[model samples]
Target: TLPVLAEPRAAQDLGDWLRELQAFNLSAREHAHTPLSDIQRWGGQAGQRLFDSILVFENFPLEDALASAGRSGLRFETQGSTGLTEYEMDVEVSLRQTLRLSFTYMRRAFDAEQVAAICAQMMALLGAMGTSPAQTVGSLSLLGPDEQAALLALGQG
Candidate 1:
């Protein structure tokens, strides 16, 4: 999924941006699916390995019909302590293409709780910006009382 990392001050134009992104994704899919007339050959080093991971997101309105036609579930075991990591994330969007939620799955790279907390902060930021899109990003109250308290404690350290 495309990551739309936007500032609170840009919230006033978020709807427009999402609409554009939706159109872009559709066009990109169409182009990607078209058969290539000539295949290009590439050379790589021996023993190169490609890794795969599964990600799943709850039902959302913006998902393609084919992708959401049946029940959604993901179950897999992650490799332990690899020096490098592969990207794995899932994002849910509203009918209007507005981002609603995200899940980052990387056992070796990041703490799940911390990632979830960041997602919560994102939701709070979106809510605050939705109400006052004209406000500066720094002026927005993106953190709840608990998060604020934690931040203050960190500052005291």
Candidate 2:
């Protein structure tokens, strides 16, 4: 995994932001083998985790691998717990025929409601970006009409 520093400007459009991210990812790939500890130390963040959340985009051909394993009389079973999550949240995006977004979050740090809101916001943002890639990052609205109306009602009170 590459440790990339995503510094996107609010005034930038989604397309621009994506391009910048792509460029950073390409550059970071060169140093992908660098130790995370070394990166943390170099960034003056020694003994501290750089990020609390991670997004994993998986596009591997797992079906083929599973088929091969089955042919060899080896069955694979999914484990309920890996027992290793240094981050507070993990978003796994599985790119199959349909996109699947799975979130694993620390219960102590966040409740189900908060995670649900975050998921809703993410879906809204993605929908907005898809519809209008030229829209500026700051101009993008994370709230729906009902949410905006509710907030407005509270503010007016």
Candidate 3:
């Protein structure tokens, strides 16, 4: 897993944030063969956890791989969950013909409603970033028009 510390500043635009990520990925590729243990040792935090959340991108064609595994007359299916998570939250992105995203979170830390809202906000932010890459990150709206109007009404009350 490639470790990426992506904290977009309020003044930074989406394009700037993306560029930073691209640069970091390129640099990380240079040391892609390095073991995670070695990296942790170098950072002087061998036993420490660096992050609580992880993002996994599945770019390979799983079906094709399974078909090529020489298992004739046998079918393979993807498991949805193993009833376990290594991190507080896990975001999985499957880069198929249609992009798919799945989020798994610890029940103790977040409720389903909260996760749903987070998903909505994330989609909104992604849409905004795609449409207006030059817009400042802080200027992006996480709330929909109805939600914004409701918040304004509550504030007035």
Candidate 4:
């Protein structure tokens, strides 16, 4: 495990947090080069006690290029070494139930309703930041006025 920074005040600023996160990432990558045999041995010995959940983030730079180039001629091969199915194959082989959330920053059209909802939430979050800039991000309210009232009522009940 990487060492946690003890500076909460420093982490309150987004820029500082980002810098610390980058430092942690560098430390993690430096420590990540363990032998395959050691990993296999650990997994083999770790019998039935499997982790129930995991979060995965993968970077596919070519995906944007492929999307821009148009995917009509693009054949999605399921068995290739570097194909999109690699992650699927891992999931199948591991027999793990995974829920993946993919967020991309490309100029692709999304469902209008979903996109509007996302934008509204972002606006709400920005408004929250404006009202309470000094508060920690975790303490900010992301809910709309109605939802906040409902939640307050529920809490009172």
Please, what is the whole-model Cα lDDT of each candidate in the order they appear? 0.52, 0.82, 0.79, 0.49
Off by over 4 Å in 4: 1-11, 35-51, 65-100, 103-135, 141-146
Which residue pairs show backbone clashes in model 1?
none
Error of 1 at 1 (Å): 7.7
The candidate that wins on lDDT is 2
Candidate 1 has an lDDT of 0.52
Q: Flag regions of model 1 displaced more than 4 Å.
A: 1-88, 96-99, 153-157
How many Å off is the CA of 65 in candidate 4?
Answer: 5.3
Query: Please, what are the lDDT tens digits per residue for candidate 4 over residues 5-121?
Result: 345453375445546767877777775666535554666833342332222344444445567566677654324343222122111111124323332222233455654565566
Q: Would you list the rank order by lDDT, best first?
A: 2, 3, 1, 4
Q: Estimate each model's TM-score.
A: 0.42, 0.86, 0.77, 0.39
Clashing residue pairs in all predictions, respectively, total 0, 0, 0, 0
Error at 132, model 3, angstroms = 1.7
For residues 17-67, what per-residue lDDT tens digits would candidate 3 score against the true structure? 889988988898888888767777888979887777877777796766898
Model 3: which ten-residue window has the lowest total lDDT? 76-85
Q: How big is the positional error of residue 89 in model 2, measured in Å on the Cα after superposition?
A: 0.8
* Candidate 3 stretches greater than 4 Å from native: 35-37, 64-75, 83-85
Candidate 2, residue 145: CA error in Å? 2.9
Candidate 3 local lDDT, residue 145:
67
lDDT value for model 3: 0.79
- Give the lowest summed-lDDT range of ten residues in model 4: 86-95
TM-score of 4: 0.39
